[model samples]
Target: MASDLRTQDIQNPVDVAEYLFRRLHEVGVRSVHGLPGDYNLVALDYIPKAGLNWVGNCNELNAGYAADGYARVKGISAIVTTFGVGELSAVNAIAGAYSEYVPIVHIVGYPSTASQKNGMLLHHTLGNGDFNVFSKMSKEISCAVSLLNDQHEAATLIDNAIRECWLHSRPVYISLPSDMVQKKVDGDRLKTPLDLSFPKNDPEKEDYVVDVILKYLHAAQNPVVLVDACAIRHRALDETHEFIVKSGIPTFVAPMGKGAVNETLPNYGGVYAGDGSNKGVRERVEASDLVISIGAIKSDFNTAGFTYRISQLNTIDLHSYGTKVRYSEYPGVRMNGVLKKVTAKLGQLNVEKGPKPNNDIPDEEVKSPEPTITQAWFWPRLGQWLEKNDVVITETGTANFGIWETRFPADVTAISQVLWGSIGYATGSCQGAALAAKELGIKRTILFTGDGSFQLTAQEVSTMLRNKLNPIIFIICNKGYTIERYIHGWEDSYNDVQEWKYKELPYAFGAEKDSVLTYRVSTKKEVEELFLDREFASGDTQKLRFVELVMAWDDAPVALKSTAAAAAKTNAEN
Candidate 1:
């Protein structure tokens, strides 16, 4: 039944913007986080009309961090802002996303063609140009950079940028000029659809590498596989689980990679960080003849300040970017190959059957038994309280340490910008994470953040209240910048911050005091009491529970020494 009808036409620019926004919506991006400015005015106007919410961020860095956190839960996220200042401020978060393999789309608005010819000093304009701005800052962090000059290029470039983000598991930048965003083009040209593909292990390379990996696996008396954050970002969870089960190898997750494989599995050892590492896990990792690190980044913090004295030769590094195979007496081979090659080879190894050590260690030896009342003490307890259905969001500072120290059960989800290391991220991120949790029907959304970080995006509490989200937020009240004090060797004034009545935040934000529980804990006993009481329960009324744990500003966690050492090493390298 072929029929011809008269078609109603809209301007090209409006149609292009609508098409791009629709695609983003199709991809599960609920909102775009950024600050509005002159260059991006048109797009900002088009956002609501296109049915996408605009999350107005206080600053660009926080906006980017929020987007990263959102992506961690939603599979993808986006941020939009103006030229130079906005873009530059967001570099830290974008770079962090790149390092951690978070898929995000960054849309920057540039000056129009007429303005460039004027040669006057424009807001957010560098002496150079918008192209140079994106070129220099976006090269390493973004998988692709597209300039929206021709209206015809809008759909294609936007689609390409989005595709690159999903393919590479990294951020991509798209620069939209003011003029192009308002100009019209043939709407018929915007019909190119997007294609989504899952990353596969290279079959050819797998055959060869698997052979090499199996040789070592068969010869080793004790072999273990270590999974890290990269495994989670690369969608290798099922593959990792299958490998663990088939190989029957003991598995341990790095601090960042916790919960990638089921923590409750018979062969699973808990996280390997500070107090979380059981004596059994430590011994197993040290005693292994071959240690296969799958998508692991052995950061000094995660590895006890690089104190795990593994012979460089006994290590096999399998990462998303590349692989490194080392031997005691020979130079190692670093190659760009698919993980399937090695996994398939290792699959053939004989399954070792026995009751292995549980890798649990006594509290005193594993960590200082004395309570420091710092964020570290809070994490393990929080981890224990968290259920598989819970989603934990951590802010920068002690909250990050909390995440580093905590162990999540198989279904528990966690999100943080560890690489970006931006302050105030967790506060706003909790909002986005909470929204995602609600959409996904996840119960018990929790946030652990520092007082300093909370101040950066405290306004989001209103958003949480308005949305009727039940998020239990624990604010570590050690004054301010606890992490910076350690990094800067206790630069007292710079690191110290003024105190606020932490428990009153929810009430100030118009939440019911009874429903929104608040606690002030100064000792370990207090912490135990509150957690055991379950004062911050979710029910008919959405709750905003705030737990203020008191500690000394200069009373750094033991892990700070490793951070300081790393800083020293970085300074020396520079």
Candidate 2:
């Protein structure tokens, strides 16, 4: 057999570090993100040999964030960190990735197995000498944890960890002992790449579920399709798209599923987050008799503080795990197969066209007194300026809510943390996303973050410059945490942020004056002129551009105000 021959071959021995890095490279990890520490210093040498670039981040936390962004854009990513302190610093970002179902392989460089067994007092470890403390902490968030002790089992464990990370679409932790870095392992394992294929659904059960959905779908006169984050995260967009388009039903997306649907489609309605949805979308969805909800995550924030008005009695929910029709459930039926079958068997439907989703950007209104930009005017105008296929990331604050009004062009990829609303996540994430975009030859990468949030992970801008990445970044210059002010802290000093000359950060981050462009725009005229500039938006020169977009401290988007008020009330409950 080929396997037996490979095991007996003369060139069977290879360093464990080389094998691990090769596996990562095979799984589409073009770059590894993390800082170098003494424990991981030697292993870093094998990265180049495996055809992987080392993306040295400013800190471990930023590294984790960047890895997450890269995974969302590039399908899978990896990060390496030193033992205790480094791993702990990156845990928050890892947890966010876990909550949102992004796949990342977190590789930790640990002290040697001998040192751990002998109870040696390592510098990164506590005096108690328990070696498993940090990894045990990660156990809560990780889908699988592989601690490589014996050289013989290392390859199997590493393969299992990476396979689980991809299949589950969640973070997995792997431990590499310092002494085992160069230990010889079977070199022939790389002869075949990882078997990363997803498990197929049971054919009989899938067909039955598909039939159940189609029955209701045909019976109802005013049926609608609702798509959500899992459709994108679980890689069911192709099937979901086919079902939506072929069925020709009125389609809508949840707030977290902003970019899943082509907004330019005639049947595509705007966001449907109960109270936070545009008025027309809300009324139409609530009135529908049958709602085909695909890959839905009805979290408090995603559903506008649990304000979803649709009844489960009239809903048929399809998920990666199973499909549900009213009171009945199909346990093993996955969405991928069911969607494909339903789309294929969809013979006819009475497609009732509703009012076309209102997408027209507003003209200059009422000759505003001073041209001060408000959230209402800014979001709509943003719709007019956006181009196709742009990677647009928004902070988990006002920008997250304001982006709802922006009508994306076809193929625009919108990134935001709705369920896992981490404040400083966007800046670091932008760094990783921009790098991934560059590798994939994506034209433009853009980011919108609050001034307060930008201060937290502003160092990632330096990483962007170091890679020669050209993402257009917009810092929403709100003086303080505007969303928090609406929630409970109207006049609290803790909500305020120190003012910084945001546009001047590129020079501080080592970008030459001519290599980058910077702007500080306040009035409507300034924003208009900046948007109209072809060179800025066209990505012709591939230069990083930073803009300080000044807005009032008290201004917040309509959705944010409603969601924040609900959050405040929920906090006060017993």
If scored against the real structure, what TM-score would every candidate get? 0.84, 0.97
Candidate 1 lDDT, 352-438, residue by residue in tens: 432342323236534775655654455566667667767788765666654655556667777766555668878777877777777
The deviation in Å at residue 347 for candidate 2 is 1.1
Which residue pairs clash in candidate 2?
A: none
Q: List, residue by residue over 385-415, the lDDT tens digit for candidate 2.
A: 8888889999999999999888788888888
Per-residue lDDT, model 1, residue 145, is 88
**Cα miss at 545, model 1 (Å)?**
2.2
| Location of the lowest summed lDDT over 10 successive residues in candidate 2 | 357-366
User: Which predicted model would earn the best TM-score?
Assistant: 2
User: Candidate 1: deviation at residue 276, Å?
Assistant: 9.1
